[model samples]
Target: ILEEHAFVDELAEREIPVVPASRIDGRTLHSFAGYRFSVFPRRGGRAPELGDSATLEWIGRFIGRIHAVGALTPFQHRPALNPQTFGRDPFDYLRNHGFLPPELAATWASVVEQALEGVARCYERAGELPLLRLHGDCHGGNVLWTPDGPHFVDFDDSRMGPAVQDLWMLLSGERQEMVGQMADVLAGYEDFCDFHPRQLYLVEALRTLRLIHYSAWLAMRWDDPAFPAAFPWFNTQRYWQDRILELREQVALMDEPPLWPV
Candidate 1:
């Protein structure tokens, strides 16, 4: 709630075309609505459209500015429950839950372990760089558009986490050579927070772990009639369950399991 308000104030203060300000209503849960609900600018406009140089450039600039604000602000809205802190990393979430199929368990486990290792190494690397607050969740759904260009919304998940957490979702998708695109996005974000390789891996693992937790929750709540079926978890795709788990394996295989390492 505070993050949303801060975003509204920050964007408006910067003259960015963000959604209108929202005010808390009398109802519980602090319900509020914005004066400007989006039409989503263009029907199929999304990061995947970054294939176009112009679109990619626009995305780059917008993200750059957004990240700049993150550096300027110290306050952040924290989540009620953080999976990275509580849940067994992304791979474990899939394994313990019924999210993954038995056949792919080993492969998924291997991959995610590797990614986790990479995440740790990334933290080590980031030790040399400065840290700051970030969007926490920078994805297509939170980013809407207007006549001017792309506008970000939904700052509920805002936090003082790795900037890569923001970059991962913005750059994670079926787009070709997404890693390259991710690198490009990092370059753009660097104009603000100063990207480090470790921060990149940390954010990737955090984002992937976030998804794993989200998927499990979605699977549990999917049966509710009011719940929409469009969520990735609702679709029962193996990759959704295995994606982060596979990455973690790469992290695990890199070094012997560290029982107690700084």
Candidate 2:
């Protein structure tokens, strides 16, 4: 937590638009009853309008500035975004814990294995891509737009990874739509930092990893009361069946050409 706060603080100091957690008495984290917590000031803003080309470009510039600063130093304490932590570890956890339904277990395992294999091929194609500190979770939900522009929140998932790890989630829709969005984002992004074309290959790979990791995450948290209430559909046979189909689709997408910027 301290590491994440410190990183956000660094960005804030550089005039990057980010909402860092507030500190109390020179400390960002406090312990009470053996539980540790950090407090962030209450912030309010609506989600960024990503459908707007201008909004997409603005976010691209923001992330580009973040990467420029993030590239300056390595994070000694944070983990790297990789297949092992994001894919393999979670998959192993679910498999070992017997979380999958008995009827779907074999099928789920087979599909996930195939998905991971596709991810491996992506890495092979993106050989020797650059790794830098990243927001790690830079989807639209993390950004808030006020009248001024967007301010990014939540550095809890911050880690060392490819820059595209911070960019891919902003994209959606058909191939052409995503390509157009990518072009807009890069138009602003390149103003601050150069992008590696090779990293494009990992887009679908990272997506596949997130899919595998998400199921495992839900299973691991099933013991928590809030989790079951919030995710009632999780761990259901239908859920695993849907995930299997999702991974199968991702496998095919991974085989397609990487998105090219306009």
Candidate 3:
């Protein structure tokens, strides 16, 4: 909670117009009373859209500034592979859920191991770069369109780590090759931070591993008939296999190290 306050305060100090936010230590996040400041817009206003090129450009610039701030101040948290809701060491959390069988568990471990090996390679090629604070989770969902332009919310996952950590999630899912659109995002980010292509791929692999792991966890919990299938083990298993094959193909090309520092 203190970290949230520090992050918001830092932004505010820099004259960035963010949604007024704060944390009431050990208090519920749902309560307005817990917030330290109040800066809101009209009630029932439509949420801003964040898809157009103009918005993307502004966001790119915004992220570049964010990277600059990060370089000035070391991050306060660790690089994490899972979301707060999943708890640390998500693999253990999954095993306890009674959904994953031995076969699935083995598959997940194998994928994670491969990604870790790739991370080692990334570090070797990129050398040690600047460690900066980051959003830690920067998917499309967290961005908002506002009168002032794109406003980002949900800093709960904010932490100190590689800039690539932010890029990895942005590049995932349907936006995998939306690199042209994402150039704006990178443009915003590079204003403050920089990373090698190898670093980017390594971080992306880690993010992918987390998704594959979590999908398995969701399958374990929602695997039922009466409840309606959210994603049963059978279907998720096939999807997981397909993704693994895709990653294998990607890593196969990485056999010759990527052109780093791009």
Candidate 4:
């Protein structure tokens, strides 16, 4: 927690727009009972309109700056976003726990194997790409936009990964549309840091890992009362079926050409 807070503090010092953790008596984390927690000041803003090319570019610049600073030095304690942590471990958890419906269990297992294989191919295609500290979860919800501009929040998922790991989540819609959006983002991003076109291969691969990880995450938190109420549909046959289909789609997507900036 302290390391994450320090990263945020460094970014703030560099003039990057980010909401760093609030200190309590000069401490970033507090121990209460058996739990440790960090506090962040409440910031008011709304999700940026990512559909706008300008907004895409604007956010891209900030993200690029974050990456540029992140590349300066590696995190001594943070983990890397990798197949073992994000892919294999989660899949193994679900398998060992027998979380899948009986009827879909075999099918789910088969497809997940294929999906992981696809992810392997993506890494192979990417070859040796650079790794840096990243937001890890740079989706729309983590970014807040106001009259001034966008400010990043939530570094809880921050880790070491390819720069594209922070950029891919911002893209949506059809391939052609995403290509255009990628172009806009890269235009501004290049102002601060260089982007490797090869990292694009991991877009779908990373997405597949997230899908696998999400199911395990929900399962791990099932005992939490809030999880059951919020995710009533989880652990259902239909949910596993849908996930199977999603992974199947990802397998095909990983085989497709990586998205290039237009």
- Cα lDDT listed for each candidate: 0.54, 0.90, 0.55, 0.91
lDDT of 3 by residue, 167-218 (tens): 5555423433455556656666566555345454455444544554555545
TM-score versus the correct structure, for each prediction = 0.62, 0.97, 0.65, 0.97
Residue-wise C-alpha lDDT for candidate 1, range 18-125, written one tens digit per residue: 554543452113423744332212233343455444555566666667667757756644543233542355345457667566766666566655555565565564
* Ranked candidates (TM-score, high to low): 2, 4, 3, 1
Clashing pairs in 3: 48-145, 60-188, 63-188, 64-188, 64-189, 67-192, 68-192
lDDT top scorer: 4
Name the Cα RMSD for model 2.
1.2
Tens-place lDDT per residue, model 2, 1-262, is 7778888999999999898877799898899999999888888899988878999999999999999988999899888989999999999999999998888889988988888999999999989877888998999999999999999998888999999999999999999899899889999999999999999999999999989888887888889999999998888888888998999999999999999731
Put down candidate 4 lDDT per residue, 83-181, tens digits, no spaces. Answer: 878999999999998789889999999999999999999999898988998999999999999999999998988998889889989999999999999
Q: Arrange candidates, best lDDT first.
A: 4, 2, 3, 1
**Full-model lDDT, candidate 3:** 0.55
Superposition error at 209 for model 1 (Å):
2.3
Worst 10 residues of 1 by lDDT: 253-262
Total clashes for model 4: 0
Pick by lDDT: 3 or 4, better one: 4
